[model samples]
Target chain A: MADVAPNKLRLLKGAVQDNVDLVRGIRTPGLGRRKLLESPPPDPVQRKRIRRLWLWSPLSLVVIAYLLLPSPVVSLRQTAPIKTFEAEIKQTPATAEVKVPETEPQAPASEPHALDRGVIPLAIKKIVIDAGHGGKQPGAISESGVSEKEITLDIALRLRRLLGKTPFEVIMTRQGDQTISLDKRVAFANTNKADLFVSIHVNWTEPREIRPLETYFVGPSDDPVTIKLASMENQESGYSLSEYRRVLEKIYIDTRRDESRSLAKNIQAELYHSLKTINPELDDRGVKMAPFLVLVGTEMPAILVEVSTLSNEEEVQLLTNPDYREKIALALVRGIRSYASNHNGVDRKGS
Target chain B: MEETNETFCVGIDLGTSRSSISASNGERHVIDSYVGWPVDMVARKVIKKTVLVGREALDNRLMLDLRRPLERGLIKEGAKKDEDAVQEILRHLISLIGLKQKSKNRAKLRAVVGVPAEAFRNSKQRLRSALEGVADSVMLVSEPFAVAYGLEALLHALIIDIGAGTADFCVMQGRYPTEEDQRTLPNAGDSIDEQLLKLMREHHPEAQTSIHMIREWKEKWSFVGEPKKPVVVTVPVKGKATDFDITKEMGEACESILPPVCETMLDLLARVEPEYQENVRNNIILAGGTSLITGLSDAVQKALADLGGGRATVVKDPVFAGSDGGLALARDASSSDWEKLSL
Candidate 1:
């Protein structure tokens, strides 16, 4: 009946602004401190640029590599940061258009944001395998009590074992049943200097029978289903407004698009071909593109493959089998091997 | 010559199992958060309606495509029908309070809705989208904060709102509770029902039970610690109605929430400033339907003994506490402020 207190008014204002910010898809101001804690150190942007520069120019790579090397006594402090090679692009328009036929790989593109093609293609040495959901975030559950978190973790661990036999260095975003925020996972992958990221997830579809083996690369998607899937997967992303906006901006222009797409295609193909032997009902949903938070944040080529659908009771039954999980892991290895062999000419036996 | 729209304010607690609304015109109502449509021509003909909501939807669930849209106090993600069901639930609640959205609408509607503490920004945005055509303007706040506001416990009060979907805890430091000042646990009424059903099956293998029946049993007989009397319910046993004494099962199911709830309560209490910690501990308020469980407040108070003794007050009317608090907030906000919050 009377005026609210001054402190009440201030609280009301804060509440109103927080609500408005959520409606506008802007991160709440109060969460800024927590976001800072989750975020990586400030040097990543500079370090990423430097890594890209080294990839683009061999001469700069030699000089910067020497400077970056640990000295015996005197630790060299980086005072003046070197500018990214994008500055050189402005002066050399002819060189931008010419695709290197000998060393460069993947599709040819003149776009400045495209993956650097001047450097010799290298075999993916470090692969960061992220298990989709864990801990409190039980992504999807079936009536039989099987959860997506457990299934993904099992498959991820299996994949790690299979990859252990190969030359590829495997890094798991989560090695156990623990809740890791998407931002933290991204920071882990980036910090570890992973050359590729493969996130494993299980799908849950309606009507229970539509089991699809799908893989996704980082790119904008117009499909409603894909958009919904991305939205669901992006829960508890823990990225602030500025970081989210930056990721959104890169969705279309990401330099890893071509490599990720190629990887997705290979994986999807292998998964469908290998999995259909065990279950003929499995459909190849094809390599589609959506801006999954994991795929968006990783600097290297990344793909999220829905290895199989847990929604289907029969598929879930198969997924529970150790041999079936082994087959899924093998299919993934084959996909990676095929992609590696094609992209960088790294043979499965040689690597 | 212009027609001016009359303004009306509303407060809504869009909960997981139940939703309550309080309007400026002294109309208050609560409904089960359910929405459904007739599954077939026969169902439509028999029900005499295209859509059913709340109790009606629950009663005629076999004949309807029933949906309890809110999962853990937020819209079920990636489900289009569930999203529509949430909208329908809101629309039904608004209509129950006698505000028509389309009848040459003369009244400007401003609503304050309560969501779970620590709800994601995306979930809040989804809730906002669900309220699009229902209200002219809307403000969303945490359910416990709304409860605290309505109680006028402005400073140094802890509100633990245990709803069907989530047990939301908020420590009121005078200002609107931030992410740090609040916590949400999934251990609430629904979890109790689940545990009860599981235990019932384990205890009486012959007794057939469903979630709906378990929910009803929990609402009637749920309690923590010692029960005043044995809880006996008549359930179907091998096609015969038989009475089963589930006192032990009921106690186990209800008390399952004690450890997490007590731990989180103490955790949040410890986070409060040292000088104000005593006041906060003494002013602990419990709201929401689950708080109505017998001896819950006493059990929580017992847990507080470890923290040098404290007080726990159960809200007299847990059902409308959030809605009333939201209504209080809606009434307090000036017209100018509401204008900026247009949906």
Candidate 2:
């Protein structure tokens, strides 16, 4: 102070005094309503500082609390539905919706989805690919530690990727390893106005080593083994047959069954042909009918494909290999592509 | 009787092979008592699951460390891992009936559990310990007493509770049954299964079968008297399933359990007071899972006919008898009878 000029010394003193005043105001006793009873009101600066520091205290505490929570809780908060909503996301405008009609109870029969025997002349605007046995239910296990769920998921995902180039709007029943009920899967297909439903499953049997690529449409079958397989699949539905038999019967009256069978045949054929290059002995178990709960109540043509048998040691080895898995995936894609290409030109009404 | 009110109370018959849960909330479920945890990280990834319960666990036993925690009608002691497995099982069971099926009213649960008659103190403690944070209040009851309480057969009824681990017997005389009125036979479902497996391995040496396969055969075709359609089942040989006749082995194995059960039935009948002995003999109740054998009751009755005139009646709902009885006990349990645990 002694070395400084007069104006500079005054400015320094004023700065010290202002900071002391700010500090005094920050720690000032009775800065609250109690102070109003005894002293003058806080000046504008003190009020502004108090507003900046203390007014948003509750919100600050909340933000801190949110940051401190567990990771799963944070993820759950982010992902859980705020409310039920229907959202449609399309990279390209879905132009084929005009060609396909949504099935109602009294709606006139449009061409059914010919997945197997022949193609129906119709545009498939939407498709649903169902990957079976997710979450708590891991469908089947193989000696090499491969699971049916993984095989189904991998194939479904690969098919989706392959079909991404097409104009079809592909919907997945599940995109991850999680459980979705059979009823829910059916509801999703029906509600989405899906033109076709393709359910993927890896087969299993008691004795093992039975490898085959089989496909199914919904109905009664003469084969006891087919009947047993239907029972096995329906057991997971957690519903009595009597509960859904009437509904299934009513749906059977419609033309969806024919389309489903056609679709199954096409897919089965493609699967056999596509995999012949890699494994010449791949068995084509042929398309058959069975009362699969997943196939029930879908307004569109639905088929459940037993892509391969997990019980078969040879199939298990093939399934574990990424290169072989891609071949299997390509086979499924070729089957669908064949049906799609054929269906585009065929006339509806069983032509 | 204390009313169960809207409070959700459950009765659990946690058997060695199967477990049944009957809740006051109108839910009755029976599941296999098989629990499996993935063996390794690869198994865990392949299974895409951590712990599998019931039939799901049984199906994926290859990639899992399958443990049927209850060996002889009681939780296996001495292993912390087994104890943990039992805890996981109880936890899964409680969640199955409580959270998933019934969404509303997730209040603290009260449970009444049935163990085989004359369970060791350590076994009871082990079971009780397993229920640590699962139930709010729990009481351990004998399998037969639970059935008696559920059936309202508190007096002059000889209850034979045959299960996977042990055949438990208890005679009721208008009060809580004691050790004197109860007898536990170790030769029950598992013993018969073991005998059947041994027989299959010895006789049909070419047939590829496991204890699991044998258990399936026993469950489907086991009989104590006349053969049921030859019990011809397909067993894999060199990865090919071939039809094998296991009728004689199954019949013999089923009968192996009969001598012990009949002997115990007679012994318990003799212990009843002279005036009530005849009534107890006439009102024999055959309960438990193994009691579902096609001709078990008839065999017991035939063996008893040699001693005196008696009847062996099979309970209609064998799976739920213990659980239903346990639920009834939970409803009628005095507040002091339960060991209350904080939820």
Candidate 3:
């Protein structure tokens, strides 16, 4: 009994410590060892301060030393040419191995380098709109034989026209009904330096009355439904298995995930609220995370919006209406404009 | 040790199928973990209440938006109403044990709650937020660990907690269990009920049955081995009641969980030090509501034949084992430690 008392006391002490750790929000040991839970880099404002200090400290020291000296002196030497990111990209081959940028060390954000993606935020200027299904790959055909490709293209064009009147520059993955590989779409966005990427898609589900308006950002998902949708969207992606695995590995550390999620939430809320006032049957599926290939490969905030469900008979009829399509386009523009206003100080009216 | 009048301590087992609370004031109560809200104006008028809980909630489910509120021993995510339901269930349990939160003269409540072995940090944090309003101080521990502590099996014992939603296995090694020492499997009483319902439907296509009825039948006759008498149940078949002998179906459903349970048990046993493996196996304890199933201990003991041989014993009070253990911990913890656990 004496021995039992000590053992019980020790166990109780351990339990108490566990509870203390929980209250302090310290993660349980051995859990979340993955890079996804790795501490994110400092916020943009702090990083900017550090970068300014680093860039000016040595110059300030040199100037002070010169002023203190009785005699003026000058030193000059040949300096090596600094390598620009554009040079590196130009030198690398198209089939070169992909590597995750070393963003962990808080590398000095002194230059406007593309690889230093998350450290600084430039104003939102260029936007890319990707219509999900195109050409021979018709996504989610309705019972009445209306292809998802036709619907997405129509909505994408409408959105492009709506945004054209604003101050932002707009780029589309395809201007017409044309087959474009997922790899080319990602490459085009990166090459053109788009600030935000939006991929338009229509969903399909059983019990046709359930029209779910959902938006997704790239992250690991355990839900079987989300996994199935991701797998279906990833099909026919030109990337090899090894490349896909590499993309998945970086999904957690993608500094853009939070920004993408914020963008998704804005779009989802706007879509649901605007459509609900007009059509009360739509279900707000809420913003979720799924590893869609397009969302995973982008360098900027990216989202995949399932505008509406084609599986619903009523939604199918609504999609066929140009006025209803115009409403969806206007709602999407409002969401994008809101996200931009929050992120890059873009004007709400896109002035 | 410390002043007792100002503090009230209780241990709660917030389970998927049922919840139990054991208080220091010599009160113990158990209730089905069900919460519901009146679904319509007519339902509100008929039920004469804004919310219902436990047996009342289950009884008036047809007129209410009934919610189980828990999935696999954790609060189901993505539903705002489910969180409300969980809060109401906790409130109901506390009220049943004579701890009214609204009473100004009531003592400051300190609680120890038990959850599944592998519950994530996010789930634990969510539970803590949910419990903030119900108790002055709260502590969360794995359910199997609580059961082991309650049974005084702190040294060399393996506890298998077979609850409705999850089967938790923990190996006690004289110190607090770690992630490596615990495993949770989503195969237990609820899975047995589902399997039994599927089998009965396949065997008697015309018979009408519901999951609730199947659950009641399982609680009465669940066993993993051969039955002494034929198991039978009466159900409506084309508007007439008929007796369906479900002995084989019940046996199949009850035995279906054995493979996964045995596999996990052996796996955890393999993880223990070879020197203490025999002692741990010799002192195996089966706990939770599903542990009361007839012949389950014998079946588990038979599975231990591969590791030489072992004994498996069921707790005398399976339903209250977790909550009782929690209560014991609450009482034994020093006042300073309790202060550390305060919300």
Candidate 4:
């Protein structure tokens, strides 16, 4: 009887080992066939044992499934429907009366049309327009006697006029030619609760031929081409090319960069569309991202626009023309309008 | 002796070059020792602020009268008006460690501030006054003792604190430091920087050099003992290209500060009990920012070996060692009656 008990125990151990091996084979990739072929089939006694195991398996499965599955009672309590019902029952008479008005509109909404469904607006709201290089900062006088500051102010005023007609309110950081520090400009946008900000400026190059209408946003993006364009727009007047390049490369991994790229793309698309309609020969200077002090610490979507290259003689001539100035303003207005329309329900007016 | 924890204490390494504060709440932070005030109404118009502290003030020094209050290991009376700025900086630092908030009632602050080893009583009084409003009580201790406390070497130990402003030494005899056990010398990291500046001026007369540029060079390449490579640095001077030969120049500048350091160490060692002198020598621990320079430990060890009596060792983490010691003291003594615990 003792010998028979030891044999039975050996058989049980063998069965458990085989089950472990089966599980291991399932877990390992490309080893199932080899494991199955190497193992012998069950003997007569083992076969009988296996038959007995099959008989008990359903009962064991019931126990295991109960242990493994989440409790139905706990799940019922956690369900939103149950929670909402409980919340309704717990509400005071005053609170319940307040909630009654919310459900009154539902009486006529049994079968709601798809068009009646409200759209979720974009998160953006107020926009602060900073016209760079105003007052004492004339900022790059062109050969044609056009000041960059004057051109920026003209475009900014036009942008405000266009944005005013839209649902989004417009706030000009500087409404007239005024000297505002970079820090103050960013602070003004932040303090006034401006949702999106734009700073307008005209660019210049040492060589006369380099002319491009560029728009800038802060930080870099996944798109390398856009990053390079942004770098070109951010270059300081006297800084060597290598120094500027190094600065761009250093800030490439900055994570808050996607916001900048999105703003740049929106502004570039609108500017290019409007400018191309007026002057096909005007350089399609693409959107770029760079570190600009005026754009820093602005808790909203911010951009800086380089309207035209003041260094180029032909571009300078166009900048001085009153009609061209109005066209530039119109293009900025179109950009602001597009941005505002996409992001509805936000107050864009200056605080 | 084991006792109940009742005294919540903090240790502050209030250095002339870089100041750090550590509390029992497991925080140790460092800030540059600088104070800034607006030059005039015109300057405020440009900067938009009346005062700036630490690195920001140093960076925009063109617009502010930057005063480094602690000069050569003591508070210069001329710069004493900066006490308000210093207090503000300390207040900011304390708030960073989660103690200054009204909500935290875990402990009352009893601080032991480590000043220069040989600081005058007047300077110590000034330090105490600076800490008066910020802490419940403040105690002034020698900087080297604070370093030794952090190391847990209470008996027969020597500490060399090579700070930017001064090299300080203290001999521990299982008690708080006395005047006899402490010594200080003024030629430290900042002194080395001054010497290097003078050298650069003599070598390259046309260079538009500032102390900032010299300090940058020192941080990058300042070394003593032996040269691994030629230290040739290309510095922009007046928007023109210039390469300065700094191999020998840097070596001389760094070495000039060593004589005073060694002398202070020897002076402190002589003051220790003769029977425990050997033990103190073996337990010599080098600490502070200047000790972070490459090969500084080796140089100190070699210098001491030349004296032929004992060995010297450097602390592995000088940056946080003093603060951690103060924290440990705070935790251990926190249960003692607040009135009984000395600040």
Best by TM-score: 1
lDDT of every model, 2 decimals = 0.79, 0.70, 0.78, 0.61
User: A1-351 in candidate 1: lDDT tens per residue?
Assistant: 146777777777777777666565444343211222333343877567535433443442233233322342113332111112222322443323221122323322344456543354466899999999876787887665567887887788768767876899988887545566777788889998999999999988776879888998876554557766877787747665435545554554567877898898888889889989879988777777676889988899999998888788888777755458778988999999898878665333334
Segments of candidate 4 deviating more than 4 angstroms: A1-351, B1-8, B40-50, B101-107, B271-275, B333-343
- Reference contacts recovered by each candidate, as fractions? 0.35, 0.00, 0.51, 0.00
Give the CAPRI class of candidate 4. incorrect
Question: What is the fnat of model 3 with respect to the true interface contacts?
Answer: 0.51
* lDDT tens digits, residue span A202-260, model 2: 89865665567788876544345665676566544633333343444433344567677
Worst 10 residues of 1 chain A by lDDT: A78-87
Q: Model 4 over residues B1-343: C-alpha lDDT tens digits?
A: 1212433457777666677878765677887777788888888998888777778788888888887777655565434576776676667667768774354554456665677765543455566567766776555556776677667676788888888887887776765454345666666889889999998888878777788888778878888889777888787777977887788888989989777677557656665677777788777888887777667767766666755657667788787666665544433332332234223
The segments of candidate 2 whose C-alpha lies over 4 angstroms from its true place after superposition are A1-351, B1-6, B100-105, B335-343
- Model 4 chain B, poorest ten-residue lDDT window? B334-343
Whole-model alpha-carbon lDDT for candidate 1 = 0.79
lDDT of 4 by residue, A1-351 (tens): 133233232322322232232223221112111122212345898567545544553443333223222345224333343333223323423212211122221111111221211342345557788877654566777764456766786677656655665666677666544544454566678888877788888887556776677776653232344433333432222222332233232232223344454566667777777777666666765665445645544666777888887888777666644457667877777776665554443333211
Two-way TM-score contest, 1 vs 3, winner: 1
- List the lowest-lDDT window of 10 residues for candidate 1 chain B: B1-10
DockQ of each: 0.15, 0.01, 0.20, 0.01
lDDT of 3 by residue, B1-343 (tens): 2328888888899999999999998799999989999999999999999999998999998999999998778787657888888899889888988877898888888898999986655568778888878898998999999999888889899999999988999999888887557877788889999999899889898999999899899899888887878888999999999999998998899999999899878878986899999998899999999998889999999999989999999999999999999998888887888899887
- Prediction 4 TM-score vs. true: 0.46
Arranged by TM-score, best first: 1, 3, 2, 4
What would the per-residue lDDT of candidate 3 be over residues A92-205, giving only the tens digit for each residue? Answer: 342121111222112112343223323454578999999886755678887755567778877887798678768999988875445565766787788889999999999887
Measured with DockQ on alpha carbons, how good is candidate 2? 0.01
What 10-residue stretch in candidate 4 chain A is worst by lDDT?
A25-34
